[model samples]
Target: MKPQKKKYIFHPKVIKNYRGNPDLLRIHLTPEYTKVDFGYVAKDIYINGGWIRIAPETFIENKITKQRYTLVNAENIPIAPMHHYFETKKDWRYFSLIFPPIPQNDCLLNIIEVKNGTPNDFNYYNIELKMADGIELF
Candidate 1:
């Protein structure tokens, strides 16, 4: 069996963009860029900081740059499952939210936390993403 990756508290942070670089959230992609894998989390959110315990309509976008990052449900899982993405390992709930390729590489990921039925009831949190030059990821 392969070595198991240690499970730690999942704190959602942009480790890097498509390009293989640290402290930068820039993406270097070709025209065929459909989706980009953010170095935030591969799977299994432990209902902690990165992953919210309560399922809220969350989306990442930069209000300053006015760019909206689309949330793509890559996994065809049920909408009502407590375990949203990875297998139920912890007692807390988990889920995944795949985002399409960011339009601009040098942009901050603004997480827009929204409430059910109440659009006014929402919060915005910036994930301190890199706003430097994007690295080519084609």
Candidate 2:
């Protein structure tokens, strides 16, 4: 029999405070890779409508061990220097980033996307890896 791979899924409840205001949807931890999903709603065209990109320097840091997992790949999102422009004020985008598997014991984490002290930085802090009610693992 094939060995079963261990997998963990987390739906973060922590609020994201940033200019882009991307909503973190889910976090998937597997033996091979850690995947993070995010949703970006296009609203307030005059204020926040524009383009968004995932910087190459983006990472997921374990709050306790301080171990950092650098981004390995991205889906439905463009890497930095390349922008994903909004077609309309109502246009929204869902994207995911993949990184090396996070250690199972590191329950708390932070997702940082280029920390430059700017208003448009997409940084989420203190993300607890726990399953939220109604989020089923498939």
Candidate 3:
């Protein structure tokens, strides 16, 4: 019999609201969908030519269902949080970073933290492909 696949959960931390830009990029505890709850403001950085930084803003918990939403969009959408799936490893974990369908130049998605684990230490899992408009997802 084949070994059972281990399922991993993604808990989102930050969501970026591009202010009319639909490239919904997000970072967090798990790798999953980029919802409005995880929305954040884009921060300008002066590194690697230049980049945008997103930070977590608010945490909302459902009173009855106990569901939590990160509050990414100006008009919040009620969604059940989700995470990516990966086979379990002793030390390594898998995640999926999502961005909006639209492309941005020199843009990238990064995993910031792993819940109950180390912080500020990141490993690259996937790379965003470049769009037809000459912009690449980082």
Candidate 4:
């Protein structure tokens, strides 16, 4: 039997074009360019000091084998602001929007839009969390 591939879970609440506009809500996932990959080994997005942080997942070592493995907490899974690429612009080709799993907390995210360009080319789409009343957390 073939090894099962790990499935990535996306949060329902995703803010697209999420740069300083809280009311301008777009569809969570767009098919235009949804196959972009960010080469993240093992990381989780969390709110810290009014900013979204992408860091390595905490893992516990196995006593017998002494091997480190990622802990399966709620944070280990990838949430909203999934992956997307834009084909409209001539110069830019790929970009991504990442969101944390925990939506209830006062979260802040820096939308790092990586544009495929020469030498050094990239853009940032900073997004701040603003939860609506009665919005359920995932």
The whole-model lDDT of each prediction reads 0.37, 0.80, 0.28, 0.27
lDDT of 2 by residue, 1-138 (tens): 344366777777877675667899988877789899999888675545677789988999988888899999999999988988887777889999999987655378889997654657788888877533324355
Candidate 4, residues 4-96, lDDT tens digits: the string is 222222232433332322222321222121111222211112222122212234222223334433322222223223322222322122123
Clashing pairs in 4: none
C-alpha RMSD of candidate 3:
17.4
Per-residue lDDT over 19-49 for candidate 1, one digit per residue giving the tens place of the 0 to 100 score: 2221212222333232322222322334332
lDDT per residue for candidate 3 within 73-114, as digits (tens), equals 322322224222222222122223332222122233332323
Q: Against the true structure, whose lDDT is highest?
A: 2
C-alpha lDDT of candidate 4 relative to the true structure: 0.27
Give residue 48's lDDT in candidate 2 (0 to 100): 52
TM-score of each: 0.39, 0.85, 0.19, 0.23
User: How many steric overlaps are in each model, in order?
Assistant: 3, 0, 20, 0
Clashing pairs in 1: 28-135, 28-136, 28-137
Rank order (by TM-score, best first): 2, 1, 4, 3
Considering lDDT, which of the candidate structures 2 and 3 is the better prediction for this target? 2
Q: What shift in Å separates residue 14 of candidate 4 from its native position after superposition?
A: 13
Stretches of candidate 4 off by over 4 Å are 1-24, 27-103, 115-122, 133-138
Q: What is the C-alpha RMSD of each candidate to the true structure, in Å?
A: 12.5, 3.4, 17.4, 15.8
